[model samples]
Target: MIPSWQRSSQGVPRAEDEIASLKTQLSSISDLQSTRIGEAVAAARDEMAHGLAGRVSMVAELLTEIGGKPENSMLNLAEIQANLEFIGLLRGPEPPDLPTEIEALCERRRLIYDARDVFGDLFDRVREVLEIPEVSVTVVGTVVHDDEVDDETDEEL
Candidate 1:
């Protein structure tokens, strides 16, 4: 049997090369998506804190830590976003052991799953306190800066 190089047309790249290129492009797309989603969530959190719950000490505390990992990672949105992006970088080779990033992969998965429970519980609590109708997480990204959560709060009042 002829080798792939001998049988194939001259100058055409191999399947492996194309796969590697596509993987990098995919990773880049994931990074951008993670960043956009993270920022949108953070902005909504900010609006909820400063706009409607200005006097609620508990909500105010959540706001202060939502943008960062807080001393104890109470509502670690920042870590969740970083984990989301890190998940994108886990592209493995065909049957790849991927030892270099395996430790990181494990750690991030654990953190993200833990954050899910904390985030969901906190989010529900916030909604209960704000007394707002159900809102989709996806819808928040569509809101431009000017049309913030506060806009709806203002209209309600």
Candidate 2:
């Protein structure tokens, strides 16, 4: 067996080296977490883009159907309301006290408002994560508006 002092001398350096390696690993993990958070923010922005596209498509379809034939506008409104429900923006059936068509349209508007609120909150969160000095979140807001315009143009075409 090795002498105790020699054994200790040999082990001390190895243990110190191991600790240093562990510290390096921890620092790497911290970097990875930061990267992941950035990726999540980008992903949230993409999701918001897709959601906005979907909402715009539903709105355009509703408008087109309404313009094409006034008599069947109620059906189009119901379809728009259904799309809103599919997206988790609206809840429950149309109230019996209100006319079905008007109620459906009202619900669609309410759902749009809710979706706007959700996107706004998400934008704020992503902005918080970015937190780049001197960078304004207004640019992000502008991009979102431009995306909406593109979607609207596509619908018009």
The estimated TM-scores of all candidates read 0.30, 0.34
Model 2: per-residue Cα lDDT over 1-157, one tens digit each: 4455544454555555678899999999999999999999999999999987876666565455335433334445756757775555334463333466458767777765665565555544444444424456796564435755887999999
Report the CA-based lDDT of candidate 1 relative to the real structure.
0.67
The count of backbone overlaps in candidate 1 is 0
> Ten residues in a row with the worst lDDT in model 2?
65-74
- Give one clash count per candidate, in the order shown: 0, 0
How much is 95 displaced in model 1, in angstroms? 16
Model 2 clashing residue pairs (backbone): none
- lDDT (0-100) at residue 28 of candidate 1? 100
**Global lDDT of each candidate:** 0.67, 0.63
lDDT of 1 by residue, 75-145 (tens): 35656765675566655344434575567667776876777677667766766666768967687766445
**Residue pairs of candidate 1 with colliding backbone atoms:** none
